[model samples]
Target: MPSLGTDPHSVRQRVEAMEKVLERMFVIPGINKPVGLDVILDIIPGIGTISAAALGSYIAWEARNLGMSKWQIARMGGNIGFDMLLGLIPWIGAIPDLFFQSNTRNLRIIKRHLDKHHPHTKTIDVQPR
Candidate 1:
């Protein structure tokens, strides 16, 4: 694979962007207090859960584009599954997203996999040996 640094449209960037969206838009506000969107959109009968699941799926898709193996993709899917499944609960799931940070966890996994397999292709050397 070409160096991720040389490619501005690299999968790593896509994943990072998604992580940012999840953190800044959804997870962060949800944690500080009972945010309305996280509660309202999350509480709606069916559409809410579906919306969240779709957002999670987007993250998994980014993982797939990054050349992650099927196992890694499945793990990302599992995170979404957990988030959606638990998030359905009245108030429990929303609270967990603040702390669990599924997107952050998935990002970590993606970073680890890319760093391990494509160290030479990265722009930075933040990965620990």
Candidate 2:
């Protein structure tokens, strides 16, 4: 399988797409709440929680591809872990997902790390006064 770190553009696009799905499809507009997938899938007993967990894992996978260090990966996993464990509760997990925005946060972290460490291939000259 191709690694995410090898292709930052594709990884970024995938993460952005997932965020859109969560924001647009899974969340409701009127009250500005996460009620679609969070509520319906979560109410489905075991599958709902598992599906959310899987979604979180997908984000983690992208983070790994983005060259996130081990520590960063662990932190990313922690976000999903909290989402899964707390979200398994009847009415609580949905609220957390609405507020947490784990994938979005992770994406930012990955971008920052990549920019700081790898940066772009092109080099810009700084003129000294």
Candidate 3:
């Protein structure tokens, strides 16, 4: 249910789901580490980083819809910028993509803001039903 002219529950769920899909979908078998389409896409040349960056923009959009401060949005953009720049490097970029997880990081920021601004509706279930 929406309150205060904001729909944090739906927004949070969608953002978190996309975060997992972008950064934590598949396991590396014996290594037991998770990697998603973002890292996989990095294997592709120019399109990978751009595609990942394009998808990452959704987090900033969600933050804007939530009425987050400009500074927060700027910080979010910086995160995406760093992720895109570093993830675009030739072969070495994949190493950072494995650890950077920008979408997850942005999700944390959104979750924090939602928790603080709307405590009553803060307990959003990120898992898809």
- Look at candidate 3 and tell me the lDDT of residue 30: 89
Clashing pairs in 3: none
Deviation in Å, model 1, residue 87 alpha carbon: 1.1
lDDT of 1 by residue, 10-126 (tens): 777776766666554532243453232333445665677667678767778777876789999988888878877767875556667565666767877888887788775355535
**Per-residue lDDT for 13-71 in model 3, tens only?**
77877888899898887877789988888877789989989999987898999999999
1 or 2, greater by lDDT: 1
Please identify model 1 stretches exceeding 4 Å from their true place. 1-9, 26-45, 120-129
Which ten residues in a row are the worst by lDDT in model 2?
A: 120-129
TM-score of candidate 3 against the unseen true structure:
0.87
Point out where model 3 deviates above 4 Å. 1-6, 124-129
Cα RMSD of all models vs. native, in order, equals 5.9, 7.7, 3.9
Residue pairs in candidate 1 whose N, alpha carbon or C atoms collide under 3 angstroms: none
What is the TM-score of each predicted model, taking all chains together?
A: 0.69, 0.71, 0.87
Ranking by lDDT: 3, 1, 2
Candidate 2 structure quality by residue, lDDT tens digits, 1-129 = 233454665565576557555443654558655433534455556678778768767878877876678999998888777767766877666666667666556656766676676676223434222
Q: Give me the overall lDDT of model 2.
A: 0.64
